[model samples]
Target: MRILLSVLALMFTLGLTACDMNEGPAEEAGENIDNAMTDAGNAVEDLCEDAKEGMNAEDEDC
Candidate 1:
């Protein structure tokens, strides 16, 4: 009986862990937003670098 109970507990724990491993909708949306923000930041940096080059600045790196 003890072994059976232990096995059941182990199975239950495994099931819970498996459920937690999958990403939910909210997490997906948050990841998308993060990626978008990163892209936007990179674009802004590129624009800054371009503007600096146009001005013939000493440091063209943004």
Candidate 2:
């Protein structure tokens, strides 16, 4: 009985590990989203700076 119980417990632990293995793809997708957002934010900031520079004289506040 004890050996059977131990075998069942081991199988259950392995099953959970198999489910956890799928998290790698999710983590990778999350990282990709994060990088895209950062790039977009940077582009917006650069455009804002360019607009400000275009509207301002050499010594005036924009």
Candidate 3:
């Protein structure tokens, strides 16, 4: 009898907790996309700066 009551109590508690869980993955995906876009933009900006520096150095050497 005690074991049955314990099992039922555990099940009820877990049910209530699980019911509140957010199962949608869209928010996580959106955050990932935003981070990726920021990284890409930063990388492009860095590349442009490096290229500009190289061009200026070449100009100085010539």
Candidate 4:
């Protein structure tokens, strides 16, 4: 029973080692999301500034 358990453990470890595990794609996706959020935030800030300037403009035709 002890030998069987050892063999089973060895097989399980080998199986885990044989599988492919990587974080490259996940890291790239996270970076892309961060860049997108930054761009969106900047765009919104610019839009808000333009709106404020328009609201405060002296011209009545807007």
Candidate 5:
């Protein structure tokens, strides 16, 4: 039917527009910055734990 064909065409167009196959430079740079910040936060947490263990603190949970 014409209605079925129209529905299929609408769905196909939506599907094509929703997919992005390329990653732009700014997006890549943002991802790198996010990763670096996460790494730094983890390193700081580890350092804090190490310092707590070295000091023989009773609560040793960082």
Candidate 6:
């Protein structure tokens, strides 16, 4: 049991150290964020189209 605990602790420490490593440069991060925003906008546009279709169908039924 003690050995298992020590191994777990060592693994946790190593994982923490890995996370501490420097991330990608700011420029790349900005570009990735911009791409994510564009994707989100496209998704929202598709949802709006779906809502419009539903509203039109409802109008036809009434």
> Could you give candidate 2's per-residue lDDT for residues 14-50 as a string of tens digits?
9988886555777999989999999999888777778
Candidate 2, residue 18: CA error in Å?
Answer: 12
**Which ranking of candidates, highest TM-score first?**
1, 5, 2, 4, 3, 6
Candidate 3: regions farther than 4 A off: 1-23, 57-62
Query: On residues 34-59, what C-alpha lDDT tens digit does candidate 6 reach at each position?
Result: 99999999888778778778777553
User: How many residue pairs clash in all the candidates, one count each?
Assistant: 0, 0, 0, 0, 0, 0
Whole-model Cα lDDT per candidate? 0.97, 0.83, 0.82, 0.83, 0.94, 0.82
Instruction: Name the lDDT value of residue 18 in candidate 4.
Output: 72
| Better TM-score candidate (1, 6) | 1
RMSD over all Cα atoms, model 2? 5.8
Angstrom error of the Cα, residue 24, model 1: value is 0.7
Among these predicted structures, which one has the highest TM-score?
1
Please write out the lDDT profile of model 1 over residues 1-62, one tens digit for every residue: 99999999999999998888689999999999999999999999999999999999999998
What's the residue-level lDDT of 5 in candidate 6?
100
lDDT of 2 at 26: 78
Best by lDDT: 1
Compute each candidate's TM-score over C-alphas. 0.70, 0.55, 0.53, 0.53, 0.69, 0.50
lDDT of 5 by residue, 1-62 (tens): 99999999999999998797798899899999999999999999999999999999997778
Tens-digit lDDT track of model 4 for 1-62: 99999999999999998785665888889989999999999888788778878789664332
Candidate 1 residue spans exceeding 4 A from truth? 1-19
